[model samples]
Target: MHGRIRTWGPGALVLLPTVLLLGYFVYGLIAWTFNTSLTDKHNARPVPTNHVGFENYVNLFGEERFLNSLKNLGVLTVAFIVGTLIFGLIWALLLEKGVPGEGIFRSVFLFPMAVSMIASGVVWGWLLNPSQGDDARGLNRLFSILHLNFLENPWWTGGSRWTTMASIALPAVWQLSGYIMALFLAGFRGIPPELREAARVDGASEFKLYRYVLFPQLSPIALSALIILGHMSLKLFDLIYAITGPNQFRTEVPSVYMWNTLLRSDMAKAAAIAIVLLAVVAVLVIPYVAYTVRQENEE
Candidate 1:
């Protein structure tokens, strides 16, 4: 016992504060939110003594607005993840070939990520403004100037709700694609040159080399990026809110809906939405975390 304490005592003491803080602020709040969701509490009855037991969740899933939000979330996730991965991979590929001014290009690509999502959303909000005719501005004006009028459309305010949500994902893709590029680029560089040489010696072409040799090794990095982006999509809020505002059902996600619900003092409903979002993020993240831990242990 004395020997174990001597070895582990300082590390345990150092970790104690962080463990307590995380337990209370993070996990504890999650528990409190879950408890609140199991209640009949709102502005009318601020006290949550009435334990409803998942009634809020049941009603939330049945609501048309919430269902639409989930649909929108699905559309945004698919678009955002696909767009970012494709673009990031392209950028990384170009950089990996030793392009001129690689450092400058990499920084330029990554600069958008340094800007906050809200700022990017505000700028993109103007760029993707649905207005046309005499009131045309932003991309509409640019389209007119370039005579690319065919490219101009109502963007996120389009009639099709799923299309609108997918369009809203463009800004998110722009902001995060660079980070994905960095991930892929790091993965590419971490690969041993011997692997490439050996593949070439085996008569593999450039395309075949990447398709069979490089990409397979990058699978772990891609999976990690997918999980990270998946959770971000699940909790998406600030960008959508900044672009379309809270009332736009076409682009509304659960996080924005939760905020709006909270504003109306619908505490139970909002907590239910938050818990649902948390559960979704966990579903994406936890599996990846387990896989990572298992890989670490095997190594």
Candidate 2:
């Protein structure tokens, strides 16, 4: 007991300041937000006598823009997750087959993730710009060259909300799929070679082997990836803001809406929206995390 305590002493002392700082920064911010959400106070003026009890939440639910933003968030989250997972799995499989120039391919895929989302958004925005030229020197040009004229619609300028949403989702997928692929590749590599060889020797088809043998092993990693991607989709802000600006109805995600409300002096509404967003993520993520932990313990 004495030796163990001595061994931990230095580590505990080192971690004390870090723990305190994290609590002050993270827990402190959350508590402050909770307090502000309950009040009807503006930045310049304090509403000392006007303590609104969930009035802001009621008002927030009544707003059409808030409702629309929530809908968009749902759409974005689902599409982003599905798209990234599918693409990531495909990328991982391709890489696993020992392709030539594997390093270059991996780097190319991950380079987008290394770039800031804001910068990627700006670049994508330019590439999708509708008013470029008659040749439509962006997405339009590429579509025209490929004889896919239907896809040449002015994604940025046109009033087609779905088109705009798809455009935004494309860049997000490009940036995120690489990270997902890395996770899946690591999971795939951890599988025993003997198991795969034995499956093949037993006349199991490649597809069957992957489905029955490999997928179950990957569940924990996949679940973790899902939780992370879901949280990211829930609080997505930088990309949307950079690509569509804060005021645009077509690209207003929940986070963007919350920002607008907070910056525009609707503190109560902002806080209400923020709380709702947090609750949504918690509902989706908490169960999965608990399940993962339980599975880990069982294993």
- Hey, what RMSD does candidate 2 come out at? 2.5
lDDT of candidate 2 vs native? Answer: 0.83
Query: Which residue pairs clash within candidate 1?
Result: none
What is candidate 2's lDDT per residue for 1-299, written digit by digit as tens?
99998999999999999889988997787767766677786554654636788877787789888888888788788888888999998999899787999888888888889989999888888788775345577777888788877777777456555666667788899999999999998999999999999999999999999999999999888988898989998888899888888798877988998888788787766777778887898899889878878888999
**TM-score per model over all chains:** 0.96, 0.90
> Stretches of candidate 2 above 4 Å error?
1-15, 46-49, 131-135, 156-162
Q: After superposition, how far is residue 175 of candidate 2 from its true place, in Å?
A: 0.6
lDDT of 1: 0.90
Per-residue lDDT tens digits of candidate 1, residues 196-267?
999999999999999999999999999989998988888888898889887987788889999999999988
Against the correct fold, how does model 2 do in TM-score?
A: 0.90
Q: Which ranges in model 1 have alpha carbons more than 4 Å from their true place?
A: 44-48, 133-135
